[model samples]
Target: MTKPLKASGFLGLATMMVVGLYQFTLLAGGNAVPGWMIGGHAHLGVISILAIVMGFAVPVIGVTGRLRTAVTGMFIAGQWGIPGVVWIGEGAELPFLMPTAFLWGICLIVSMLIMLYATLTQDSSGIGGEATGVTPADD
Candidate 1:
């Protein structure tokens, strides 16, 4: 659960950072919230969950080499890049973020599907395989 812990922990930290930032906006500017703030808050939860899921699946799936790299990139992009783009788009008043969002969504979904497939199909080392030094007798 180390990877999951780190992923979720970072998400928690990011959530708190947003909380403080929004509070600052409220105090200094008075009731004017940037769309990016809302977007970041909204998307971070989804991304965080995705990250945690990936973290858990990583060890079990035993992904290696290029597949690992691809999955990692997709997960990170989905978790951070997409929402960050929205945040920037809102902040900079860019209208082209929609296409980027779609692309990111596709990347995220594909990564999730791959993770799912791998997790479902991979051979589980099973409980105390190390202790017994045998393949899983059964699920």
Candidate 2:
């Protein structure tokens, strides 16, 4: 897995944690939590983890060259884009944010589908060394 993807994942988790702390502080201060913040917090965690997993998955699925680059970029974009637009849109009370969020979500789904297709069409017909009972050390 690449460092960038893992770093992004960790960064997302850190952001989520910070948001959670802010939410707690808000509650403590007798302020109501905003719905947009809640949504952003959730997405930060989810997308971050997905980015990390996809980092490991990309090479396993044989996604190389330009396609790999595209998919990785897409996932990285989605890791930050979804939550960012949501927070900005909802925080600023913009109506267009929801559609933008949907678009980001769709981007994530498309990235996953690309990796899935690669996995499905592989010659081994299985993922990782375990599927074939062959360990990396054997290779």
Candidate 3:
């Protein structure tokens, strides 16, 4: 497990806890949520899952060092902030969240492109060390 994966797992757990807290509050006779509050639910569930999925995917792509760091930071922020912006903008009514979210998304895209380029251009496959002219199992 990589540092990023651990972080994402924590975020996923946090997201779940937040959702549970909301439900518990409602069950306890807390005020009913406004329709706009639904964004929080989507963020907590979808965004968190996306981050967790990317966490596992990172290893398969063989990200490491500074590149890993960049990918982790961008992906984590982007995944969470994608929904976070909606919460901040629509839920909290903050106008600035959109720009912040946009920046995070851009960073995430760059990191993804970098990961794709590196993974494609470089043969991180261990097979190169062993035998040549042999294709991958799935291939």
Find the candidate with the highest lDDT and give its number: 2
Q: lDDT for model 3, on a 0 to 1 scale?
A: 0.69
User: In candidate 1, how many Å is residue 120 off?
Assistant: 2.6
Question: Which candidate should be chosen as best, given TM-score against the real structure?
Answer: 2
Candidate 1 lDDT over 1-139, as tens digits, reads 3364346537745774776677687979767776676676668766776576667666656765666667777777777767767767777778687568888888888877776766666677741134755677686
**Residue 68 CA error for candidate 2 (Å)?**
0.8
CA-lDDT, candidates in order = 0.68, 0.84, 0.69
Ranking by lDDT: 2, 3, 1
Summarize candidate 2's per-residue lDDT along 33-103 as a digit string, tens digits.
99999999998999899888887888777887777877888888888989999898888888677678777
How many steric overlaps does candidate 2 have? 0
Worst 10 residues of 3 by lDDT: 123-132
Q: After superposition, how far is residue 47 of candidate 1 from its true place, in Å?
A: 0.8
Off by over 4 Å in 2: 130-139
Could you report the Cα RMSD, in angstroms, for every candidate shown? 6.1, 4.0, 5.8
Off by over 4 Å in 3: 20-32, 127-139
Scored by Cα lDDT, where does model 2 land? 0.84
Query: How high is the lDDT of residue 49 in model 2?
Result: 94
Model 3 C-alpha lDDT per residue in residues 68-135, reported as the tens digit of each score: 88778877777766666767777778876667867867966886787787678666664125566777
Collision count for each candidate, in order: 0, 0, 0
- Looking at candidate 1, the ten consecutive residues that score lowest on lDDT are 125-134
Q: What are the TM-scores, per candidate, against the unseen true structure?
A: 0.70, 0.85, 0.67
